[model samples]
Target chain A: MTRVYLDNNATTIVDPKVYDVMSPFFCQMYGNPNSLHSFGSETHPALRTAMNQLYKGLNASDDDDIIVTSCATESNNWVLKAVYFDKILNGDKNHIIISEVEHPAIYSTCKWLETLGVKVTYLPVNHDGIVEAHTVKDFITDKTALVSIMWANNETGAIFPIKEIAQICKEKNVLFHTDGVQAVGKIKVDVQDVEVDFLSFSAHKFHGPKGVGGLYIKNSQELSALLHGGEHMGGRRSGTLNVAGIVGMGLAMELANDAIEYENKEVRRLRDKLEDALLQIPKTFVVTSRDKRTPNTMLISIKGVEGEAMLWDLNKAGIAASTGSACASEDLEANPVLMAVGADKELAHTAIRLSLSRFTTEDEIDYTIDVFKKAVIRLREISGSYAE
Target chain B: MAKNDLIGGSIWEEYSNKVAELMNNPKHRGRFTQEEADSKGFKLIVADFGAESCGDAVRLYWLVNPNGDIIENAKYESFGCGTAIASSDMMVELCIGKSVDEAVKITNLDVEMALRDSPDIPAVPPQKMHCSVMAYDVIKKAASLYKGVDMASFEQEIIVCECARVSLSTIKEVIRLNDLKTVEDITNYTKAGAFCKSCIKPGGHEDREYYLVDILRETREEMEKDKLLQNANTVFGGGTVAFNDMTIVQKIKAIESIIDENIRPMLVMDGGNIEILDVKDSGSHTDVYIRYLGACSGCASSSTGTLFAIENVLKAKLDNALRVFPV
Candidate 1:
């Protein structure tokens, strides 16, 4: 069976080159990046090289800083919590703003902070999932501490106006953080270009290891450390670094960057063709913003069947897809993001996310279309949700 | 491979056949026709919690000989699972010679206890116990009908499972399905509201509505005692926990064991847990671990419900620490 993986927004296959670069670090080059001995010192160069590669990949100049963390989740929590914690202690800022469609890693953390007496303002997004610059401007108060938004939605692949939002934050002298986990490899992300104060990315989102990620804090800013332990990442992040994971992430990033042009063009073409073919099926609705979306993502909501049931049927037919946010797939609760954009509860349940990658092929798409067409037809018959 | 082979060649085949035999015996299964019940003096009742998936109901047949001569040799039919069908088989064996009135006294608790002899039923006692209660209620109803009394007239005295608060009519309506032998089977047929906990068998606990016998007196007393909150208009079913209901705690614990030992570890591998906290006796929490034993621990969707379920249950039963964990 030629398995078609169309859930790249959830995770991706680790590139073989990334694996080759990481193999030595796992065994022969196994040493704590924090250690001072020759054994550790040998691995230190590789770790530094990885960090430097990432720094360059994101267009960070000599004055920029990068902090290595465990994953995008840790980076998000660290950045959001650190800002709030620093503001509280420094007696300078207290308010935090975020888009309603931010990932749970950011939204949930900010929501969690509200329980601690921190004030947070959730700015709503338009139907296209773009946060208006005015909403950002309106929400920023003198007490505003930070504005965190995701660069690209993991579900709809809708691109938020990060550059505009970042500009507003800069004008107001507020720290800007963008969860670039979904945007980094699929789309070009230059933190300097966007003027983002902090940017977070995970390796596994782009064919690197799962447990490793990166946090970029512009070198000019003096940020507080998130984890307290043996000094690593220049005392910005603590604990021994995941040398193998870091190295893999660096290689993955470099490869992803090199393949961006070709993959983007190819994936977008295939994605559009698949979307058009799928939409030709009766009562199917496209979920991604037509003009502005990640090249690799296409979300569809079949009118009459549950997204989950269809996913299972497709899985049996060798085409893997997802419904709504991966975090809330089995919730039975409709997608809050879909709801935020005014999607009906039933439509939210019917929504299916089909994210592609450079590896996705034409035959795979054709097979998926065939499999999905049958699954949806069968599910529709059993679903008994047809309108009169 | 060897393990599956062992089960396939030995235990699995026998278990499947036994379940099949019980399930296939339709002459003895389903709602007993009026003539059949009069002849055999028994009926099969299956209550399904439809809102929940799989088994969440009390499904076992009853031997209702209203005149008190239980049919000692009556056969049963079940199409659900080994435990449910076996429970039906066991119910017939336990109550056959006993009178219908005597059978009315039988509970799902009894059927689950009877199931202790059979290991293939997955041994979820709370749900099995519910099955027992459902069987008891059906037999009692059938016995009342045989005696020219309307069982529906006494709604207050007939408590289904105290934890579930399912009514006799609810059970009757739920169990009217044809091919139910397991709680999960009932769920498929009826869609009973078993969201918060297991609805597999009917024995766990009953969530009874509080209706004062002396309404005026109780009202005056409540007003005099200034305990107005106790008499608030909460829904009359299985949502709230009763302070005096000790069995509910046991049921919750049993559910915890099933989730922890059978369902949770898989969710944990995906980083989730159905946790309970603030277990109020000492203001401490109990961290139960359900080590996923099958191919499910690594499944992605398992963790989706793991934390929320634990938190929801704990929030209902306990007071704190119902937050998400790193699992």
Candidate 2:
């Protein structure tokens, strides 16, 4: 059976072209970018090229404004904690604002900061999983240090109004950070257009190799480094540079940038076909709103059939899917993103996430719809809660 | 290639092969209809159990004989994850062809171990162990319905750890069999107080009735009592030793030897040491005054339970009328 991988939001397969661009850096051009030698000097140009590629992909103002990190998690951690640590030194700001449906990287870090006596306000989202700009505006105060929200939710795929929210933060003179890990490559992200002070994106979320991501700081905002070591990336983040992974990320961003139009058209059409077919099944409803979400994501719930059981059956039929955020699925807890959107416990437990990629084909979408319908029907047959 | 490879790779290796097989195609994963029970001449017993933490529920169906002992057929319906389905299926299979009494004896560990691919490794992840606990609870519910007893009767065995579903008897048995030294040892052996850690001691994230610290202390006391009883029997016969007939010096010597032999080591293990302060013969009863030093002075159990235990040991070894007083 041909495998249909629909869980692109978790991680995507590395593009073969990106792999080919990175293979040579593993052995031939291996050098520590910080070393003062020819081997290191040879790596500076490649690093500069990768930096320029990322700046273009993110539409950043300056190529030197981006700091390469391990992944989006490190970028998010650095942005949140660095701002709070700076506030501690200055002793002026004490409050931080964030959305409820943020990834654990932001949510959990803010929770940890709360134990250190830092005040935090978790702005609630509406039933469509959209965080309103007015909510962030209302929570702003003289002591508010920053406002951090996600560009697109990993679970429901609901896109927040980042541009409007960033404008609100600008009016209030508060820093704004958006976790653009899911939205940067799938959609067009121009840091100048949004005016977000900080933005984070991971390579692995697109078609790049893992362990390399970028953080865009507009106007070269100075924040304390989370990882301190030898002077690398102007000492903003320190460690040996992942040359091969960074090279792959640059090539992947270039490819993703070139394919954005085709993705918005072809990928969106295929996702809509899958979503429409899935909605036709009995007792199934799409969880996220159609207008304010990513083009490739469809979160749906088939009432009375458990999401995990459905995912297992889908896996058995050679289709890969998920029951919302993969990081939070290890436990039996219902999806908090679903609950934040006003879904009851039963609906949250029954929700499944299907995220497509630019590489997904029309035939794969059709096959996935057929297999998903059968799995839902079969699981409902054995389920005691499903009637008729 | 394996069919699991079609999904890209096999993360299912985290689960046992038997668990994966049973979770995919459960054998006893349907409702047992009353019509089917009527044709088989068996009374149907249906019991429902729900886990509030995870919102998972399981309904167990048992076809018991009219005399209400043997379970002839069993079926289940689970409204949860793959682990719940596999556990409920295994629970049904274990209940069939057994007497109601025998079926009720099956613990959650029994059901979990039966699903394990090997003896040492767990069949499912630690967080998923509660699925098996739900299955075990449904069995007791069904058994109560069959025998027309209160569901509370089935819960007579006290549960010390709710997270791991460890009973007080199981904790005590593990403590005695392996001579578990600390609360950490109990967690390593029986997995009690491993997750959430509210059951490890008091003042945790939640309240629990029986913490592992309390269980370990109580079990160690019981073991010590048994050892003292054995020592008393060997040193003194069935005949009562008359403490009044001896001089005060002899009484002090005998009490000192007993304390040195039996109780000192136990107290020292818990970072405490006890010293005998004074003893007075009050004609009708012997008054023994003792003082607790070191960590015991600040310990909460030192004043009440530890003092009572010391009195019991002295009473059992010497005269029944001897009293213990903390100075």
Q: Highest TM-score: give the candidate number.
A: 2
Instruction: Give the per-residue lDDT of model 2 (tens digit) for A56-116.
Output: 8988875438888999999999998899899754669999999988999999999999998
Please state the CAPRI-style docking class of candidate 2. Answer: incorrect
The sequence of per-residue lDDT tens digits that candidate 2 reaches over residues B1-327 is: 266437643345567888888887889877778899999889999898873224567889888987757898888878777777888899899999999999988988899899998999888865566667778989989988888898779776788776577788999999999999899899999888765466788765345688889888988999988865664554455444466665676578678877987888889999898898999998799999999998888789887999889889989878898998888
Runs off by more than 4 Å, candidate 2: A325-332, B1-11, B51-53, B162-165, B169-185, B194-327
DockQ of 1: 0.02
Chain A TM-score vs. truth, each candidate: 0.96, 0.96
TM-score, structure 2 vs. true: 0.79
List model 1 lDDT by residue over B1-327, tens digit each: 255446321322233333334323322333334566657644433222211122212223344443445544344332222334445655666666776556656665565555453655533422223434444454555555545677665345554333244544444444433423445544344444342233333222233233212222343454544432332222122344343332334434544644566546655575544454423332334333333334444655446664466556655554344333423
Q: Tens-digit lDDT track for model 1 on A282-322? A: 88877647677999987787766655456656766678788
Best by DockQ: 2
**In every candidate, what fraction of the native interface contacts is reproduced?**
0.00, 0.34
TM-score of 1: 0.60
- Alpha-carbon lDDT, every model: 0.65, 0.83
